[model samples]
Target: MPRPARTTPSRRALLGSAAVLSLALGGLAACSTSEETQAAAQSTAGGSSTYPLTLTSPFGETTLEEKPEKVAVVSSVDLDIALSLGVVPVISPLYGEAELDPWETTALEGLGESDLTTYDSTDGVDYEAIAAAAPDVILATSGWTLDEDYEQLSKIAPIVSFQGADGLTGMTWAERTAEAGKALDLAAKAQEVVDGVAAKFEAAAAAHPEFAGRTYTYAVIHPEQITYESYDGSDTSFFERLGFTLPAAASRFSAGNQAVSRENVDVLDADVLLVGYPFGDEGLLTRSALESDALFQQVPAVAGKHYAVVDDLVASPLAYPTPLSEVWVLDQLVPVLATAVAGS
Candidate 1:
């Protein structure tokens, strides 16, 4: 049963940290020199410098008068992608602030650039702050969709909302990055970024052939019996991106573009399972249920102790697709998966 929607201090604090924590644990990573190396080696788009660029955004076609300089990215995910591409916009949302979020401090320490200004979303966005940055174009995403605030942002610059594009709609992190690349006129570069990550997964898979035939399943088991397991092909998820296969039973539940959950968690049967929970709260419920369930204990992964506790924000399709989330995935998840696969 879904937990009652009660707002306690603890609940509110957790809910607030959830977004920040997810940014840390999910796939947000600074653009590494290694990734840059791979990108440099990839085939380029040739000599297309500055021209009238028309980008297909979620809202509509955004025609750039001449290679967008002084851009404003309203989404943290978009901020990460833009930063990764080495193009810092005039204005971007702060991931976490110094007083409120220490994770942001550590995350940006080695990233080498820090000219961004924070926009407090608690009240409406400060249009004057954004205008002060002198952005000619604004890139807004999910939260701003249909919100009156976007209209105010639009008055300052041509705001292209990402909540509407088919390419970005419910896309995985990889797909989202590709879409962002298109917006930046870095389509070829985006393709290379994905190709490079996929290649790493392939190498890890090759090193750990045992996982080759292994079937994996994922879920978020919240307190009070809120269990969500993947239900389809689009649910292949980052685990699938990292070379795991979904069980046949769960294959039929694929939502095509989004991650859909099963009504009954008991239907989740696979060789391996990944459970997620919030950060500060003890993962007592998830741990206890998995440990106590006979069917869960009998799974191949459980018998072999192959099951892992993944951060929901890291694994969730909604959070991880942004450039911000990818960094987290690489740092926290990839290294562990690479080692596990290598040894297994």
Candidate 2:
């Protein structure tokens, strides 16, 4: 479904939109706050919030009776957003073995958080654990089940949920960040964080003038079919931010999903073909099927080796593109993209 033009959200309405699976499908942790975190949470000038701000989610409206000093985040995307704004939540998704994106881990360390009171979200929201942290607000902006769990969660504190977001795909990174900022009472810092990441993309784009006006398609190489990410959705803003464009034909589908069979693989042809794989052998196995297909082999970019196949870890930026992920993958992606566009 097409998204409506955004209005400045009222006390009960929301202003922004969601990210991808890395956040929605990835690990969920509920961390704790500390004195160092309090110090780090100080916003730059113009980023303060007055108390009793009312916020809205799809489930219901609630007023943040005060600046939320202790937040509980349901997704890593929101965790990244909170960390970027320099506020440490009291509860977040459990990182487990995969841990957090380097940017976030580093941020946590910088904030003097040596340990986290983590909980596995795979079983679902650990309301007991969240309550244990005694949070003032919950950041479920990118949560898949925020609707069903909103009431239960609100019993603990106000929920700043994502509004107008597509199911699962949630809000764009920018939208998520802005919403998190508004909820945290650090709107100014949120924009500052967004602007900082934009400048990074701008620098990458400026350094590589060839990327300007170039056409590209980003997709995941699944086994039976190929799913394309939209330039307007699925964090294709990562490419657009890097001075690339997604051709109308290359866009193939919308709402950040919609699979195309190998027979129709020609739609992906562009100046640069970027495909990502799952973390393990599954991605390689699927990639083999895609590359072996006669139709895929004939695509100009693929035929000329003007493409880049990245592992899932490196592709999270494409999926979510949060302030943390964006910075983490910039150096890694630019060189790969540069080679693809070299088109030798």
Candidate 3:
């Protein structure tokens, strides 16, 4: 759901030179524009806006004394929520080297490329780079912000930590958006976005009565091992919201994920199975391998071909639940799931 905070060394090593250059250049740009932007942001932050907004997280409570204009977001999903609320963050984390994902490319229309600064948080929260932005408030709801990181960020501005079980991954997309709205003094707008997604789910269920009473599970196909990791919570919640039930066998694991070996693939058996794979040919090969496995073939979903293979790009937002991403996901995912159900 939320991006993991502890990025592996290989991932950190993959940071492109261009992203580094952008961060370097963005810092320089932020410095040159700080005085003017900060002045304007302060005026908005203090004027007519809700102040002393307090949000409680696992770490403790953080109260924003003013409405924030210069907001900095460490979590990648928060940026999307900010944009949807018409508040462009002064600084946001980059999704790897790319400034935006495919869905974001369309969602962020009319926003200037230069309006936002981007940084890499794969290794950890970039306190120094974030401090450079000089924000009035920091949104770290979706990032891996530890207690130590929270303490450091507090020195920069009023910061809202993740509002769920853990720092990085607990909050549902709706919860995170609502929290962001409260912090930004746009509670009504946030509710509207949440309502919109709820309505979409209702529409999907109404359109496909067959989806009702069906049991389904979404699993990740590990590239290295011939195993499936079934995820609960947000991933299952998506289906549950649409009137599907998660099988009890898969629901007992409250840790969000339950790993099942290939020989024990029945743990993932359900009326429908949605498999996610790494992007490209590797994903296809993995899907093929799973399909060809005799043990996997014994599962009802596999036997009936009542499964859909989703790529990483499409799976990320669905796996983690965000307002904009949820809407985008429904548009692209419903048809696939519907097809799987029809076959089943």
**Pick by TM-score: which candidate is best?**
2
Residue 105 error for model 1, in Å?
A: 7.4
Which candidate, 1 or 2, would have the higher lDDT against the true structure?
2
Off by over 4 Å in 2: 1-32, 41-47, 95-97, 165-170, 231-235, 255-257, 279-285
Residue runs of model 1 more than 4 Å from their true location after superposition: 1-50, 55-62, 95-111, 141-149, 163-168, 172-175, 223-225, 252-266, 279-300, 312-319, 327-331, 334-344
Cα deviation of 109 in candidate 1 (Å)? 6.0
lDDT minimum window of 10 residues, candidate 1: 3-12
**Best of the candidates, lDDT:** 2
lDDT of 3 by residue, 279-317 (tens): 324322356677788887888887897878764556556
Instruction: State the TM-score for model 3.
Output: 0.77
Q: Give lDDT per model, in order.
A: 0.50, 0.69, 0.63
Model 2 / residue 309 / CA error / Å? 0.6
Q: Model 3: which ten-residue window has the lowest total lDDT?
A: 18-27
User: Which lDDT value does model 1 have at 314?
Assistant: 48
Off by over 4 Å in 3: 1-49, 55-57, 60-63, 110-115, 164-168, 223-235, 251-257, 279-285
Number of clashes found in candidate 2:
16
Residues 34-86 of candidate 2 have per-residue lDDT tens digits of: 75656655636255666788878767888898877788888777777878888
